[model samples]
Target chain A: MNTYIEGILILAGINLMAVLGLSLLTGFTGLFSFGHAGFMAIGGYTSAMLTVKFHWPFIPALLVGGLVAALFSAIIGKVTLNLKGDYFCIATLGFGEAIRLILDNVQYFGGARGWPGIPNYTNLWNVLGINLVAVLVLANLIRSRHGRNMIAIREEELASQIVGINVFKHKITSLMISASYAGIAGGLMAHYMTFLQPKMFSLVKSTELTIIVIFGGLGSISGSVLGALVLTALPEVLRSFSQWRLVCYGLAVIIIMISRPEGLLGGYELTPSSMKKLYNRLRLKKQAGKQGLEGGDIQ
Target chain B: MNILELSGLTKKFGGLTAVGNVDFKVKKDSITGLIGPNGAGKTTIFNLITGVYKVSEGKVIFCNKNITNKEPYQIAEIGITRTFQNIRLFKRLSVYENVLIACHKNASYSILDSILMMPKYKREEKQLKLQANELLEIMGLSDRRELIANNLPYGLQRRLEIARALALKPQLLLLDEPAAGMNPDETEQLMLLIDDVRKKFQLTVLIIEHHMDLVMGICEEIMVLNFGCKLAEGTPYDIQNNPKVIEAYLGVEG
Candidate 1:
């Protein structure tokens, strides 16, 4: 494959990692966050510092980056996850902007000037491998009792509590796991681009991640993966349109939202069993149509 | 032995008292009914007992333990679970999943165990599935296991809520109007089902109901609340004969 296509694929993989985490939070848990880019920033800077300043290995640094992001999310989640509904969304918006502005003044990692000379360790193979593990782990977690509790909390929080689920604890847990994913994604992006800037992890980046999740469909991992791949490549595919590419991208998103409000897959999964069920239903419909035609001929 | 005791229980919202200085004792393994007109604070009492609202001034003693002002989940964890006045099944989930989510507390496998698909996770999960299926079977929802909860008939939705509560293996079950939207035939079935559940689970039930026939049929003891105060408490016969209870239900003679 050409380097251009390979680069886009790698970018899509990184975005998929973050979208999977956000999918767990927004889709399954019913919590909306607009501060995930801040997590990416923390991970990016932490991992970059480890590799550049201390000469640490790539994978361990990435894991440490995710851990740091999870730590920060735990603190923020404790303070704001108690706020119900849109209040939590607003809190995360403030948090994302705050992280960016704080990073702007920190001179240790090149501050507003941006950091360069980061090793190019984020190859397509590593990205693919990491994303595979992420997806499997996420799929397993969603199918478990813990995942069911999160979905229960999302569906009806009061009922979940009445059913013996500790809602607050589960909310924080979702937030922390989500942040860790964003953190790892950020580390990958930093190494891939071989550069970092506070501005790169702005509110827009966070909004983009959220949009990808919603566009994919809530409560479906496969939808997030498809969404990440399609959405990340759309702009690059439209590059020939020049400055109008973004306008075209915005139009495409609006069209999808209007046409399918529940999202591309809604809450349905694309597993083998579901596919088989769909196929059987279609075959039965076809058989019924044939029977109707035969009855018409007899008439 | 009494399974639950409320002494001087009161809940004041600003100056408006929802449940005021009410006291009652629920005998162990007995189906106790709480009934009154609308706004009589029956649901408020359920909320207070479940820790949805903090008590203004009262003591809620369950099994000789003072559990007043605990979190709702904590109250549930301590073997007290409730069904809402409004049927609050996880609406988008399937019938089996609705009950299975409640069965979560029974399994103690960690998140790591689940994500990594450990042997312990598989073993516990298999057990939870069996338990969920059994509960669904008992609730008569086995055939509709894959149906979304919101799509179930109103009466079955109510039944599903009770089944979900039972999944917690709660010692004391507080049911808020399990027969609200149910028809006469459905109500009759519900009465039998509630009685059967109580016997099978060896549960102590405190129920709030507006249906006199169902309440009178299954409840061994009844507590009447009028404007947040205890109006009367006794057997069905005693409560039917009480003049004050009659006056409260049907206005005093003009």
Candidate 2:
């Protein structure tokens, strides 16, 4: 593939990594977060420091970055996960902004001036490999008992508790896993761009991730994959329109939201079984139509 | 012997007392009825026993353990589970999944085991699935196992809630209005189902109901609550004849 297409694909892969985590938190666990970009920033700076200052290997550094993000998320979740509904959303927004401002003041990582000379380790193949692993791990987690508990919490938190689910612990677990994904995504982006800036992990980036999750459909991994790909590529595809690009992007999002409010997939998975079910239903409809035609001829 | 006891249990929301010094005992393996008028704090009492609300005063002892003010999940873990008056089934999930989720307590596989699909995870999951299916079968929901919970009829939804609660394998089941939206025929079926479940599961049940016929038909002992206080506690005949209970329900001769 050409470099331009490869670059976009790599970018889409990174977005997918973050979007998948957010999907688990928001879609399955029913907790909305705006601080995920903060997690990415932590991962990006941590991994970049490891590579640039300590001469660590790329993969290990990325894993450490994810771990650090998970740690931060655990602490944040401990404090804010108790807040209900919109209050929790606001807390996460505050957290994301707080991380950005803290990074702005920290001079060791180049502070407000931004960090440069980061080695480029992110490639299409590695991005693909990491994302493949991410998807597998997520899919496995979602199918497990733990995953059901998270979904239960999402569906009815009080009922989940009544059914013996530890709601607080599950929420924290979801947040930690989600943050680590964001952290890994951040590490990848740092290496790909070979530069870092606190501004790159701003609230807009967080909102963009959330918008993609909503666009894809809540509670569907395949939807998240399609969403991250389409949404990440849509802006780049609109680049030829220059200054009008954002306007068109916003308009397209609004149109999709209005027409398909439940989202593109609407919590439906695109698995083989579901696809087979759809095919069978369509065939049955065709058979019914043929019977109706035969009856009409008799009449 | 009593399976559960609430002594001087009082819950105050600011100046208002939802349940005031209400004391009761649920006998082991017995179907006890908690009957009262609206806002008479029957559900509030269930909430207190299940640890949904912090007790302002007094103790909740279950199976000879003081379980007052524990977390709801902890209450469930210690062999107590409940259904909501409003039927709080996981609406978007299928009937099988609704029960399966509750059966999670019986499985001890770690998150790592689940993600890696280890032998322990597979074994536990298979067992849990069997348990869920068995519970569904008992609840007469086997045929509709794949249907979304929200799509089920109101009566079935209540049954699903009970099945989900039973999946926890609790010794004591607190049911909040199990026959609320059911017709008389459905309510009759529900009464029999409740009796069957109690016998099969070896359970102690504390039920809150407004349906006089069902309560009178099924309850061995009935506790009446009026303005958050225990007005009467006796067999069905005694509760029916008690003038105080009568006045509490029908009010003093206009």
Candidate 3:
């Protein structure tokens, strides 16, 4: 029972990192990245090979893996972010597949047979510590001036530029940050699983990260955290109806979209004083109108 | 000396010449109006000056430097800011956030310093919040500072757009069709607000507006464009009486 609990923690912590990374890119910056799993592969393979071959320490190996992913992201973002909207998304999807194919066919690092003996060094404490750092750094980044500029760009690029935000530069910086976080997530994941294969970092995994961001509203940091937690737990809770579990999940998604499309948060944010303000506003609306609820502007 | 000088500025969309070799100057510390009916290339001229569209010919001199081909951000960095005709507020961000984002550029904090939360970033961020609140107060939107920008009333949205532009501390401010779709009372209030803002900021203001009363009530000088050419340029009284300007507005397509 303890081992099972540990396994779930490991999965949740690692997935929290990856999905938060996706949230920064697709959710906050509105970049629509589909290459996170590719960066994850870079992190996973690089850290795994370094540890197995060179016998490097865990922390340094993790950093190197993140750097490698960042390098790839910078190159890809430089070319593809200029394409605008869905073009960048599709280009990233291609990039993810290309990375996977290259990894699968490679001569070294065990190729398709996968890399083993990765040494499961990521325990609950390590997982929690790393996830803590990820959340802290992401929260700070979102609150910084760059984060505000990113929100501006995401809302309206032209207005951002007219106010002197170099949109392209900000986009690349954001992509790099997101890529590095994904890389770290992958490294932690590789250690937790004690092995890795090229197939593990697939387009489906990338879609999963994007779905987390979508489940949470874009531009809402708390939404990302909540979305990751719910998604990680919901499947386990539905295991009794094993055959219908995925169907139930799919139905929940549809129902949420059909009923309230802006997402669970509807782009509404939770800052310190906002809780009080929200209560006050809800009370005011209830008193003013005969209706008990209102779907105010989501964006 | 003029604050912004455009010489021989032309724009071409395929074979059609949208704006043809227009020579224009906007002076400092005064409200200038750019007025024309639809299809007169009034908005196109704004687009050219602000670097939204590249000029096919000639130079744009801002504060005595040739900025003909600079990107919009670069132009804005030199202290020229503009608002869109459609009111391009950052819709997803809070009204306060929209203003603070513009304020970030001028705050004296390095990127590394901000990420590390140096005392400077905290101090600046707080100051920026205060400044944003004051600006919102000036625009009568202090109560709605936390509201998502797109949710603001139409008149309040326009004021917020101006507030965001003002956050940049611009020397030259261009407002495109700022009085669009406003009732007479709202337009009158907007006219006073524009004057108040210009006086308070010591700003060189240029507005593209369709409201004749708004233009005549406030603008010291007005430029009328017709078919991509300058039809009239004078004080408000002269513009109201100019034959070509009147004909351009009233007798177009005849």
Candidate 4:
């Protein structure tokens, strides 16, 4: 495989890991956060520190990074998840910026100058391996009872509470899981680039992740995978336009939103069974119409 | 014995008192009705009972436990569940899924079990599915189990809401305007259904309704509210003959 193609695929895989987690928070649970990039930053820097300073193994360092991100998200969620709607969004935005600024002044991790000498542990195969695990775990989670509680909270908070769901507890659970995913993705990106800089995980990075989640279709894992792959590669594919590339990218996103406001799949899955169900529904509707015509002819 | 006891239960939204200091008791395995004219705070009383509103004064004791100031979900976990007046079904999901979501109250598996698909998860999940289907069948909604909740006709949507509430297996079930927007035939059927479910599930029900015939026909005891205050409490026949109840329903001559 071409190294350029391999790099893009690896980048796509990393983005997919983060997107999958966000899909649970934004898509299934209906909570939006703008500080996921901060989680990734924590994961990348912490894991990078372990590998560089403490000489930890690659996979264990990645796990530790994810754990730290989850812990940080739990604390943040306790404080901010109570804030409803746009206030919560603003709080997360502040969290992302705060993490970046704090890292900027921390001299031990090279601060704003960036950190180097990280191991190149994130290859395409390992990236693919981790993403597979992430998707399976996410898919299974959705199929379980706890997953339904989260979706209930998304649909109607008051109704969910009346049904005995602990909305706050589930929101925190979602934030922690999503943050851990972002953390692992950060760890991968850190190893892949062999360097780290707080600047790399900015508010822009967080927004980009959210855009991918919405563009992919909120409640479906397959949608996230497709969104991550297509969106990550879209800029590279549009490079022929040079200066006009970003302009085209923004226009494309606008067109998609305007045309199919629910995103690519509209909360529907891309499974063989789902496709069959759609086909059957269409056929049944047509049959009903035909029966109506026959009855009209008899009349 | 009284399953739920309310003493001077009051709720004031800023300056407006939605439910004034009032007392009521619902006997176990009985169907009780709370009826009032529009803006009489019947729903507000239900909210106060279900923890949707904080009590401005007095206490709510359920099954001998002082449940005042508990969170809504905590109140639910303590065997209290309710259906909204406006039909708050999970619109985007199927009827079965809506009931299954409510069945989460009975699921015993841990989050880790769910993520890993452990045996305990599978067992509990199978049981939940069975319970949801059984509840749907009981509600006469088994045939429409796969239909999205939003697509259900108005009456069935209301039924689905009740079915979902019952999935919590509550000791006390509160139904807010269950007969709202129903035709006479539907309202009649709901009265019978309420009676049947009360007997079948061994449930204690408190219903807020404007359907006088249904309330009068089914409720073992009735309470009337006027401008956020309880005006009458008695058997259906006694309430019908009560001068104060009649005055509340029909303006005093003048």
Candidate 5:
């Protein structure tokens, strides 16, 4: 693959990992968080600063960045997670902007001039491995009893509460998890790009993540992966037409959503059950071909 | 002697007194029926017991523990679970998942176990599936295991609510208007199910119901409330003939 194309794919995979976490927070927990980009910023800048300022190892710095983002989210979540409905959205929006402004002005984090000379430790293999880990962790979480309860809370908080669910605790925990994932993605991203800027983690980045989650089915996992890929590649695919690309992008999203509002897959999950059926069918076909070849040899 | 006691239970929303210092006691393992007119505080008592709302003033003791100010989930942890007047099942979830989600508190798998899908998690999951299936079978909903709770017909949905609450394995089960939305035939079946379940689970049941015949048929004892205060408390026969109960049920025919 071309280096530029490979670079884009790697970045897209990182963004996909971050958005899958966002999908769990917003799509499953009924939390519409605008602060996701803030987490990404936290992760990217922390990892970048730690590596450049202290000369730490790549992996440890990245992990520390994730933990720092999780810690930040826990503190912010204590205040913002309680705000319901539109209020919650508004609070998260403000929080995201506040984080960006802090990063933009703070001298330690490049003070809007942007951080440079970070090593490009992230590559295709690294991004793929991280995405695999992200998918596995989230898939397990969704299949568990706690994930089921989170859906129940999303569907109806009052009923869940009466059924003995700790509403506040679960919401906060979920927010922290998503935040940590975003942070990790951000840290990986800074090392991959070999440069960082506070403006990279602005509201536009948050909206891009939101678009992927909303365009994906709210409660579906693979839907998020599909959404992220298509949305990321749609513009590139349209690049031959040059200026018409944005128009094509807008029209494509609008048409698809209007035609099938539940997203491409709706809420259908690619669970182990369906995967086993596919594997069985493929095995049967392959076995039949093998038998045919053996019979031909006898002839 | 009472296993659960409520003393001076009064709930006032501004000028309206919903429950007016009404005292009641629930004997151990007894099915007590609370009946009254539309606005009576029967449901309010269930809410108070479950801690949906803080009491304006009252003392609620369950099994020698003061649970007057306990949080809702705390109330459930202490072995009390209740259904709503309106059917409140997790509608979007499958019937089996609904019951499994309720049994989450009792689940033995740790968060790490779930995240890792270790041997212990898989074993517990199998056990959870079995337990959910048994509960669904008891409620005559096993065949509809994969059906979403909301898609079930109204009567079945109400039963699903009961099934979900029963999954908690509560020592005390409170039912608020369980038969409200059921047809006459369904009501009879529900009455039977309620009695059999109470016995099978060894649960102490406190039911607030409006259907007089069904309540009279199944309830071992009766408590009558009117305008948020106890109008009468006795056996079914005693409650039926009491003038105060009659006045509460029907205007005095002087």
Candidate 6:
């Protein structure tokens, strides 16, 4: 593959990891967040520190990075998960910006100016490999009883509690898992670029991740995959438009939201059974047409 | 033995008292009915018992366990579950999936086991599916199992809510207006279904209903409340003949 193409693919894969985590929290659990970039920053910085300062291997450094992000989310979730709806979203936005400003003041990690000299260990093969594992684990989790409990909470909080589900605990669990995913994505991006900067994980970055999740279709993993691929490549594809690219992008997103608010997949998963159902409906329509012709249009 | 007891049970919403210093007991293996005029705090009492509302001043003792001030989910785990006045099924999920979600309480697999699809998870999942299917069949919802919950007719929605509540395997089942939206025929069917389920599951039921025939026909005992106070409590026949009950329903001459 061409180097440019490989780079875009690597970026898409990293974004998919973060989107997958956000999808679980937002799509399945019905919680919206604007602070996930904070998690990614923590993950990226933590892993970069391990690999640079301690000479840790790529995999272990990534794990520790994810752990730190999860820990951060746990603390934040404990305080803010109790807030309902938009309140929680605002709380997360505050948390994300707070992390960025704190990092700006810290001198050890090369404050405001940014950290350099990180290793570039991210590659196409490993990116694809990690994504495959992440997808597999998420698929299994969604199909399990625990996942069902999360969906139940999403659907109806009071009903879920009446049925014996611990809503707060499950929300915390979701936040931790999602934060770790964002963390891992940050870790990969850090190594891929061999640099670190708090600016890379700004509120805009967090908004972009959330936008990708919504654009893909909430509650559908396949939708997230397709969304990550298409949206990430869109700006590059529109390079010729230059200044008008962002305007076009904004217009396109507004149009999609208006036309298909549920998103590209709309919670309907792309599975063999669903495909078969569509095929069978078409066959039934054809059969009805045949019957009509044979009967010669009965009055 | 009493399955549940409430002493000095009270609930105040700001300056308004919805329920006040009331006491009641539900016996084991019995169908008890709570009937009152609208805004009489029947549903409020159910909420208090199930931990949806905190007690303003009272104690809820269940199976000799002091259950006051517990969270709703904890109360459920301790074997108490309820249905709402409004049908609150998971709207997007299919009927089978709805019951299956409730049956989640019965699963023994850990989160790691579930994610890994370990042998225990698979085994338990298969069993849970079978149990869910059987429950649906008993509810006469087997044919509609694939339909999304919100699309089901209002009557079926109520049945599904009951099924979801039962999936918790509670020793006490509180139904808040289970017969509210049902037609006469459906209400009759519901009475029979509730009785059959109680017998089969060996459950103690506490139901709030405006439908007097269904309540009087099935309740072994009855309690009436008015203005958050217990107007009367007795067997169905005594409650029927009580002058206070009659006066409460039809105001005395001025």
Error of 4 at B213 (Å): 1.2
Off by over 4 Å in 6: A293-299
Q: Model 1: per-residue lDDT, tens digit, B1-254? A: 99999999999999999899998999999999999989999999999999999999999999999999999999999999999987888999999999999998889999999998999999999999999999999889999999999999899999999999999999999999999988899999999999999999999999999999999999999999999999999999999999999999999999
> Candidate 4 docking: what grade?
high
Ranking by DockQ: 1, 2, 6, 4, 3, 5
Model 1 agreement with the true structure over A141-241: per-residue lDDT tens digits: 99999999999999999999998899999999999999999999999999999999999999999999998999999999999998999999999999999
| Model 5 bad stretches (over 4 Å) | A275-299
TM-score of chain B of 1: 0.98
Is 1 or 3 the stronger prediction by lDDT?
A: 1
CAPRI verdict (incorrect, acceptable, medium, high) for model 6? high
Instruction: Look at candidate 2 and give me any clashing residue pairs.
Output: none
- What are the per-residue Cα lDDT tens digits for candidate 4 across B1-254? 99999999889899998888989999998889999899999888888888888889999999999999888999989999999899999999999999999988788898889888899999999999999999999999999999999999999999899899899899999999999899999998888888888888889999998988889888999999999999999999999999998898997888
Model 2, B79-132: lDDT tens digits are 999999998989999999999999999999999998899999999989999999
Q: Report the lDDT tens digits of candidate 2 across residue range A42-123.
A: 9999999999999999999999999999999999999989999999999999999999999999999999899999999999
Q: Write the per-residue lDDT of candidate 4 for residues A73-190, one digit (tens) a residue.
A: 9999999998888898899999999999999989999999998888899999999999999998998888887788889989999999899888999999999999999999999999
With a 3 Å backbone cut-off (N, CA, C), the pairs that clash in candidate 4 are: none
Candidate DockQ scores, in order: 0.91, 0.90, 0.64, 0.81, 0.62, 0.87
For candidate 5, write residues A29-131 as lDDT tens digits.
Answer: 8899887899998988898888888998887898899889999999998987778788888887888899999888888767899888998788899788888
Q: Give per-residue CA lDDT, model 3, range A71-180, as digits (tens).
A: 99999988888898999999999999999999988979778888788988778888788878877787787888888778778889898999999999889989998998
The residue-level lDDT of candidate 5 at B176 comes to 94
RMSD of each: 1.4, 1.2, 4.1, 2.2, 5.6, 1.4
Candidate 3 C-alpha lDDT tens digits along B1-254? 69999899899999998888888899999899998878888888888888889999988899899998888998888889998889898886788888889887767676577767889989988898888887888777888988988899999999999998998899999999999999999999999999999999989999999999999999998988888888889999999888888787778555
Off by over 4 Å in 4: A278-299
The Cα local distance difference test for each model comes to 0.95, 0.94, 0.86, 0.92, 0.87, 0.92
**Tens-digit lDDT track for model 6 on B1-254?**
99899999999999999999999999998999999888999999989988889999989999998999899999999999999998899999999999998888888798899888899999999999998999999889999999999999999999999999888889999999999978899999999999999998889999999999999999998999999999999999999999999888888868
Query: How displaced is residue A267 in candidate 6, in Å?
Result: 1.5
Among all windows of 10 consecutive residues in model 1 chain B, the one with the lowest summed lDDT is B81-90
Question: What TM-scores do the predictions have?
Answer: 0.98, 0.98, 0.92, 0.96, 0.93, 0.98
Q: Sorted on lDDT, highest at the top, how do the candidates line up?
A: 1, 2, 6, 4, 5, 3
